[model samples]
Target: MTRDAGQMPEELERAQRFAWDMESLYGDDLVSVVLYGSAARGEYRRGASDLNVMVLVRELTPAALRRAGQRARDWVAQGNPTPLMLSHDEWLRSADVFAIEVADMREAYHVLAGADPFAGITVDPADLRLQCEKELKGKQILLREQYLLFAGEPAELGGLLVRSFSTFLVLFRTVLRLSGEAGVRDAEEVVLKVAARAGFNPGALLEVHRARASGQPPRPTADSPLAVGYLDAVDRVVTYVDRLVREGGAQA
Candidate 1:
């Protein structure tokens, strides 16, 4: 498809050009070029967010990597992340492991070239829930470590929150899905719903988001740690996921 519902013209054109380039470089070896992440989600910020692309191929080789290295470098130099290259067999086999990412892209992606690899795909709910809990806890650990290291610098502490907010949003979306709240993609709506469901104050999270959007470090909300409320919010989410009934199959 040449267009996605909410994409801006420039973004769409760039994605199409990248797809065309990949096709021209790899020919039939390239299975598909999919646009996902924030850009594909209609949450793109021209100067800030990444335009995440995933290229699926019949086989991934050193030769293939060498061929696309320059183009990938140019793309990253333009402020986007390096394009993700995966083999078709790997894509199918790893769905059980990368369920969170696969399912998100499956739900929100645009197929810029070839066939839609996610068509008819269904992620295992047990895998999704397990990953949800694992990633939530893992992120909580990462945040604590960040806090311990940067506690002295309030602005850097705030920067940690701003940098990590987007990642937390992705995690929150997966948790909501496991909790039976699917299809809530709006940023503020996701925050509100997650706060309601997880029983955390959304204030700190929203503040972090505002700081991120405004391109500034968040102000200290509490005296000591500066991000006390923010850390507490993440902790609550970890605890909430702990109590969740591990759901799977049809009901999940």
Candidate 2:
């Protein structure tokens, strides 16, 4: 019983209802029920996709996480599927383990019957920006190395192009999150929105996309035209943060 974007509201309501039902049976120990993955991002298909969810609880006794796991398995056995149940410690500690993407945060609604202990959980925008920048720096280095390594091979060039485009999507999504915009499932849509709101040039982003589509070896240089577009996008993000700091100072 998953659905597509148009049917998201109904699906979300059902998920909330399911969370409530679980809370009633399990008592007040449950922290929150988070709907994750593509369905959470309003991209599920009725016939093909399973809903991904995380049930975060205060302290699951050794028996409880196991029981929860068994219950989830049973749900799948019944032809309704969901993913893991995580305790509070696991979720918080794992939050910074990787570059958080649009798919990671979209459609996250808290469904809790009673007072939620995790209600005040806030992901600092500054922290997210730093994490994103760190990831971007790493990807930029990796892409440059890969390009040099297989400069003559068309197949390797194509693979590097794909990786670079994927990294661009991650960078764009991170900017969206920093700006308090909900994550978008579509990479192109996210890039367009980032360009519009974050003072980036959309034409530049489209150029990167076009280069990626061409399946050609990128020109190698310190200031390669292909690299310029991505670099410009990164500059826009830095400019955005600088503007925010200035505006905040003025307000103060």
Q: Name the top TM-score candidate.
A: 1
The TM-score between candidate 1 and the true structure equals 0.92
lDDT tens readout by residue for model 2, 104-221: 4533434334344234344545555566666666766776677677666656554565446655665666666666676466756887888887676666556556555554434434
Which candidate has the top score in lDDT? Answer: 1
State each model's CA lDDT, in order: 0.82, 0.58
Clashing pairs in 2: none
Task: Write candidate 1's Cα lDDT for 1-252 as tens digits.
Answer: 544434656877787788888999999999999999888878877665778999999999999888899999888887778899998888888878998898778768888899889876778887887888899999999999988888777777877888899989998888788778887788888889989988988888887787677767775633544388889889988888877744342113
Badly placed stretches (over 4 Å) of model 2 are 1-35, 43-85, 92-119, 163-167, 180-186, 196-252
What TM-score against the true fold does each predicted structure earn? 0.92, 0.51
| Candidate 2: residue 227 lDDT (0-100) | 51
